[model samples]
Target: MAIRVTSEHDLIIEGGGMKIIDGRFGQPLYPSSPSTNHIVLLPENFLVSGTEQRISRRDFLSVLANVTRVMVRASYSTEPSAVYRLHSFSMQVANPSARGERRASAVEMCSCPPGYAGTSCEACIPGFRRVNGNLYNGVCEACHCHGHATQCHEVTGHCLDCSHHTTGPHCDTCLPGYYGNATRGSPADCQPCTCPLNLPSNNFSPTCHLGEEGELLCDQCQPGYTGPRCDRCSNGYYGKPVVPGGSCQPCDCHGNLDLSIPGSCDPSTGQCLRCRQGYGGAACDSCADGYYGDAITAKNCQPCQCHTNGSVYEVCNKETGQCPCKENVVGRQCDECMPNCWWDAERQECMPCHCSPHGSISQRCDVEGRCICRPGFVGRRCDLRRQGYERRETRRPVERVPIDTVQQRWGGPSRTGGCPRGAYRPKTGPLTHGITTGGQCVPCHCNSFGSKSFDCDETGQCRCQPGVTGPKCDRCSRGFFNFQEGGCTPCQCSHVGNNCDANTGQCICPPNAIGERCDRCAPNHWGHDITTGCKECGCSVIGSVTQQCNVNTGCCLCRDSFRGEKCNECQIGYRDFPQCTQCECNVSGSDSETCDMERGVCACADRTGKCSCKANVEGHNCGLL
Candidate 1:
């Protein structure tokens, strides 16, 4: 079996996988390549570290394994060198006299471990990390991230950048407010709580948590609201606040009903359920015939002040009390503004919302008419520029992150075999001609037509054909387009910008024109004027198939049986244009058979099929007189 290193902490021996057979700490390492994004592991000289387990070369090559991020430290080896050779004292040279013999020592061979190399076993290889001790004393071990994360801390082995809603030192559990089995390592193992009255904009609860029985529960309801979903109002309130545009207001009983017990007013309407001390009326707003003064109002009956915020408040009166609400409010002691209207304190009025039609989420605005803008746009009314968005910019395509482990969403263990899909362990070779041959198993990202080949180097840098740039060879250089295997062709359009369709080499057309060079008129217009575009064909519906035209003559092709310039009339011998028919007149008795219109003695009456007869002719066809 062949073996080689493909990245800073990975190896490839079989099955096109970038896994590590083994490694040790404190090896002298240099930068792998310019494009690899690998760091200078260590200086030319480094320490010789220890390890926990020792394995033979056979065990290392047979086992499929992996190594994660690590660090390199320095320490000197203290072992003394030993020579193992004997010298002969015989005068083998051509000097036959009694001459002194000179001796020489031979170099010895060392058989170090799989992770070590050197005449004296002084340096350790990569794929292992050690935080303590120098090379000769510290140990190195493989890193694991519990399948929930792809990477971990270099110094510590803690998992980082957790996914599938997991969080912890090892990503072994789900985060707060989420429930389910996180240890299963599946993306759907954990999930959000399904609240009963849940809404996209108005979730009345602060959070939903797991109950004692492991069931999801909405625990935190806002003030004046209660229930599992914060949908119901308290004893003294009314209205279905759970629904959109609904709010809970205090009972408008005017203090005529006793609220010591419960059910003093209607749950939806402000009408009192039961009046107190001979009181009667819709909200008990007036005393009964036998009742005395001040039965509806309290002893010191005064207006209960209100806290006018953006949302619903507690204090309230009847439907039309007109208590003069807060700055932006007008509901009888209510604090919230009406739908689609914002308060204008300077003018003391509620004006209709004026938000940007394209940028704002809705017409509703804040007290200052400030709208909630969409992403990449910002302003009080969602109309101002947001830096890079000042000019119309095309949106870039989105690239998704690669997943290392594959697991079932519903259930089951993870599936592991090699590097992530769309990735491969590149072939290993010496660096040559400013090109990196091998380093990592990364995505083979290259343009189909712009690159020389789809195969990428270890650092995922594709080889471009010529004028193609970008690491993926997806863009053309010098404002060129129509990229192909050999190179990119120069753009031919007059209004082309930096980019265009790389494969077609077509020009970006204006809204009113379309063609290879944006010189042709649109389908519904007819003219060469790009400024005003093509004028609308205005083709007669009974004549045109496209209901529009693109011809330079500014007219539509007439349908069968039609002849007028606008195609609105029938042909010479026919009557109804859309449902035209041939004229059949009696030839022998008629004056002429050709519907002669040149002299103005019109034809076989176009509408009646009657023939114009000669002199002495009287009957329909001049058969009798």
Candidate 2:
């Protein structure tokens, strides 16, 4: 067997097992079990005798047999060949100088009990709990005081705070002064006691107890209370009870014995017993309706004067005769008219009517504002003037005569007698025979393009036809020409001309025209004709470089080769040439190199038949002999 020790008094045994056998034959010592294979323990107080402080085999067996109450001494000691095979064991101490403080001398099992430390459990350590078994055979654990306590009971592990309400080995139960649950896991479970409001302050019990189910339970009640709730007074009493066996007193009567009848006073509130006769109010000191004066003082009531037909009630106000008025009457006696009625001074009676200021004349209307209309007027409220009396101004009548009769009376229709060439008779009066008012012989103020004559019709208005206007019709109107024979013919100005003048009938030319009719070519233009409009000049760039040409004849003034009207075409003598070209005459014998442009004939210096030859040759037959 081998043994191990710790600083906390934990002992450990290791090996295959322990065996005891006979020495002579090497057989098992115990017959039933061949070998003893189990751990053994020794008491903490079992010690050795020498200065080395080690346990002997004899001493160890003796203590073991005594502790286990077994026959271990006989087997190991009697057998001469009995042998013990021990494994090695060693101990590591916290400090070698304090090796004496270690409990290594004691022998036990693998672990030590709580509060005991070192290999043999010989010493008790503070703040550790004994777990699993008694203090002799268990391990040491740190005591858990739940942070609220620093230490606890060594064996039972109860905390120690007197002021705390809970109780138990762990200080976890309700105390005498507190109530509610008092168990571990939760903190401060108990609460202070409070009695119900109906209980007297001095006589009430303040202590409470917790039931097994963790509910609060109160103590006994005071007097005059019966049930478990203790909220009500006992029987034979009406009001709240104050003392033990207490009962409420009866109410009193204030000299009016008739008012002391039953069913009047409330037992709890001590109010009136009953009211007598026609008295009302909480004290029964005032009078009732249909009677006047104080019922408590005078005691004799007087009647009121209210009109039977107009008053709403028989009873009236006590001081005044004012009663509830009817639908159409008011005042203290119920004798006056209502808001919509007026009193008539003469008739001495009330009448119902409404007169709006906008449509009536008086407050007390007779025929709905009896004068619906004023004097000499007829509509509502005298607002309209009467017919046949309307206001107007006087006007005189005018004398008239026919236009023909006025004409004949002035003179006659004859040229020497009647109105002049363009005149007619006046429409609204006798004709004035002369030109004093310009009334006689009124001209036909015709437009330029309106008419062909100056004589007006009988209405004294001028006559006008199309395209003419004026008093004499001598000129054209806006768009017409003034040609003499056609009278006022419509002007046919081309697109280049907008319109003709009224009197001259000439075209109002645009920028492209040079003549009054806009039919001529403009400056620096050529190739003008009636069929095509004027065109820009096309003078040759080399021959007539100026580009300007004659506007009337469309001819160019340049060299002979460039001879067309615009100087842009070649002449006869220079056919197919673009620029100026020299004539191709025989110049060796001719007077000039140029040729006739129309006939293509060359000029000669000899003055012969328009031909010249070399000097050594004969005339027409020079090439033959």
Candidate 3:
């Protein structure tokens, strides 16, 4: 058992065995021993005090139990011991012990309630709180609803609904021109107010009302009208709504006639007769001068009909249709002219027949009726004939001949020196007489070198050099061959055969072969002329057009001048043998040169050398001379 001494009193108790005491007026202070390891004791009222100065035995026992429990708890909280040993002892209890034990005080355990946490169980759950100290046991007594407060709480302090013109959780007031009903929700419900058309209002709310004459409410006067009611004309009218005492009045043209004369209609006469000649209108405030069309019209006088021509009637004073002239002429109509001639004022004519200087011409009159002299011959009557007349002749100068005409005539070389090569002259009359050949008259020679310079006299044949050809060797080369004045020039590599054809430089390639160089042949042809530089072939065929022709095939592709199996004979158009040298003359009197023997026709030179004619009259071979 243990004893507890409080600040006010002390307590004692017995342990291991408990005893009870009965009171005359109340329940017993002691009960049976505590069945559990720990027990608690509390006063019914915290303000009450014990009657005795010391604690009762039961209370002291309760405090001992608490102290034991606290010790056991503390011991359990410590780390376990590392070493251990055991000792055993036995004793028999013949009689129950009546001894008391003392122990220290103990503490009580604490447990938090639902929705509350902390050592004292004082705080409420999340999202639920107490404000202004109005909550207990973690329970809220009041709570803010929706979104109406600046600071919402589950207890006490909370904001109410917002005002009509204010919104948001803090009751923020809306600005002018804005309105809303959103107190606890989103701001989407807010909106601004609008006013009617032409009836603007700065106030958020506007009301409608009736205007004068049942018109809608208006702000200001409209055009041409005035007054608050807007029911009267401004001015310039003779009516009621704008009477003298009202907002507007009728125009007093009489008193306000600062621009014109004033007059009025006569009631008794029933006519607008009381006005001046130039005044009219209700108060004679306008022009009535029969309007002469412009400001120049007189106030009371009639308009002057001035002529458009600025002649005749300068100004029509009377209302008559005819116009009168102010002076001679110079008016609207043809009514006047100068006083010089027969003055016809109505016709504005003044005929003055005057003669010009050259003659009595009626067409030369001046504006004043005077005549002018004609050009080149001047006189008043213009009838005088001038003196002096004669005929003259003009001629161009003739050129004279100079004495050096003889030298100019015989300018060129005589005879041989002036003669052209390849042309001949007879050794007769002119040569025998030894006349000097002058002025383009010169003898001709066949040799290009000189006359009779390279001649073959006895043989009567031209011994042409290697590069020279032609009858007299006048031409260095013949046919398709070319020369540079003296000797024949070699042919281009692409040209073949003895001479290129006159019209074209293409080779006369043998049959079964082709190409400008004669280096190619048709398929199936074989020959050394194309392969071995113009070598003769000894194939089985003597002269076949096909390569390696057999004896049975005979000749092929005969020479142009001949036609035979061995190319040994000429064709019908050819006359001579061997090379078939013969001429062929056409009906036009043109002839071909001697032909090649192996070909079918003559190989003639076209437009080149002289020819052996078919009907000769003189000179070479077939001639008659």
Candidate 4:
């Protein structure tokens, strides 16, 4: 590479073998021309041999910084010859086809090569990092960030903005939950690990890697699933992994079996070996044949209590314990007769007692079929009103209620056997509730100021606010203080601080800190840092303009004639620090001054009080030459 020595010139490229010619004139340089020799044409201000002797290093670098475009030949010769040009990786040059064959362009410039840039390929592009201390070079390679980053460090070539679970300077390392060759430089090189199947967040396996044969080997499986590939259920767990979208499920014996003992049920089918007492089934979820009531919850099953004479079957409903009764019979045990009917012992059936529906509390009568009467009505049918009781018009049979309001209340005894809509489960309730949308119960009167929200969990414990403590969130946490309505304020006493005052919320500040927050330097100090704290100004009391300094840099307010950060030294050509006396040496005869202000050193004329005397005449101050 050649650089111009002055502002009047530009850089030049060394032309050895192949080179580029002007497109307008290069087309005529065919091999069939009469002349074979080509004359050398040079750029403007080019130094011909025997014209200029040397070039300096400083002038060479100036050429590279502001290089102009390269130019083709200015030769006057008309002879045509086969010519070559500078070709980038993508640049293709094709000689004109034989005379009559379909013609083609002599040259085509697709684009600069991967790492090359500028008009004459004078520099590297953004995608490529500099190798020769940030300058033009042909050996630069494209940015290799393993497809995780588009840009790299300009000086170090370290990749930046790496994504897709990648890390390291070149983004060639895979993060957890991923595997494959991260250095391949392709987006698909690194892939997510899947022991059995892939999922967005949680997976059956926690650690996996590609095996020697390229098969996936899971190092460890998450709970609820087992096996080398996490393809099978663990002991006491059940699932159908043979089918699509199937995940392992726990045995869930519902407190019927001792969970502490392993292998309580079949891992594939979830069949329990035995039940606690009245519970029996695949998961011991229902009552046995001889038992009734809930077997899964409450576990309060009782023996069947059906009346032998009225009930049709020996067994009752296992859940609700309602027995199958004969016709015209009602009650839990199926022993009572229906309304408006009486039992006939001889016929083993019920007989109806027809009564006036308007005057009687009910249509039923005595066992002998004699109709009973209401208080205000008379006769066996009770159709007539008595003495002072006047008959009123009766609007019989009310209309049905709307279906929307006929829904059940959550956790009501008759509805869900739990709690009310506004109330949550009792404290210390078992398991997360799927019944409530929050998966936990919440109650009213929960602390709104100190808690995360006005809600308590199933165990009746309120969620504490951020940086809060105490059961009722009345106190600040370890790193916080000054608790009030909104919340507590965090301590900011720098890294050296241990604690703060609880009531006042004042930070315990470091020894070097002057501010309460420890965010700024002390008076006469600067450059406050968390680890090192504030550094002393250390300025010279006499040489400094003032005691003040830059807070972040600790740079002193130096006097006009002083140099150095602390203003302790005088400027060049000065004599003293505090006084900063200028050197009065004359360069014409005294030579250049090398003043050491601290020692009061300066090159005076003749190394004496006055100038040296010449061969003929002499005086002082070099008056005679």
lDDT of 1 by residue, 210-246 (tens): 5688676677666656676567776677888767667
| TM-score for each predicted model, relative to the true structure | 0.25, 0.20, 0.15, 0.27
Candidate closer to the true structure by TM-score (higher is better), 1 or 2: 1
lDDT value, candidate 2, whole model:
0.46
Cα miss at 462, model 3 (Å)? 99
Q: lDDT per residue, candidate 2, 1-625, as tens digits?
A: 2221111211322211222211121223333334433322432322332232445454454443334222222223233444443234433323323647455433344465555665446334665555554433456665554433445565666665523466555555666656665654345666665433323442233566655775545565344333333333322213344444333434342322242354454545555545455444465455446545565665543565566655788787764546777766778667666755644556544556443333234443331222222322322233333322432322521212234432343333424225665445455455476523424454445432233333566654455544555555555666776433213555557544337676665667644556767777776686555445577776677667476777766566776556666676665444445633433444344333344535644443222233434556444422321
Instruction: Name the runs in model 2 displaced over 4 angstroms.
Output: 1-39, 42-238, 241-323, 326-625
In candidate 4, residue 443 scores what lDDT?
50
Q: What is the C-alpha lDDT of each candidate?
A: 0.53, 0.46, 0.36, 0.59
Give me the runs in candidate 1 sitting further than 4 Å from their true place. Answer: 1-147, 154-158, 166-184, 241-250, 253-262, 274-281, 284-625
1-625 per-residue lDDT for model 4 (tens digits): 1211112222233332212222122223333333232323223224422334233333333343444544423343333542434332222223433476655442233366777765445467766766665443435666788778878886678988888777888898877777877887777776787767676333677667777987777778867677667877776677865355777787788867545556667767787865666667877888877679877668787877888767898588987888888888888888777888877778876666667776566786645444545555544454544433444655542222222322321112211125443345554434456543334334534443355444444555555655577766678887676664334656544354536777786766655775667677778888776656787889889778878788878788877667788988876545444676655543333322343445543433322344333344334433345
Q: Cα lDDT of model 3 overall?
A: 0.36
Off by over 4 Å in 3: 1-121, 124-138, 148-150, 153-156, 160-178, 187-625
- What's model 4's TM-score? 0.27
Off by over 4 Å in 4: 1-121, 125-128, 136-151, 160-168, 174-178, 184-188, 198-207, 211-214, 219-222, 255-262, 274-625
Report the Cα lDDT for residue 621, model 3. Answer: 31
| lDDT tens digits by residue: candidate 3, 522-602 | 443444252233323333232233443322342356655556655556554544455455445232332334433344233
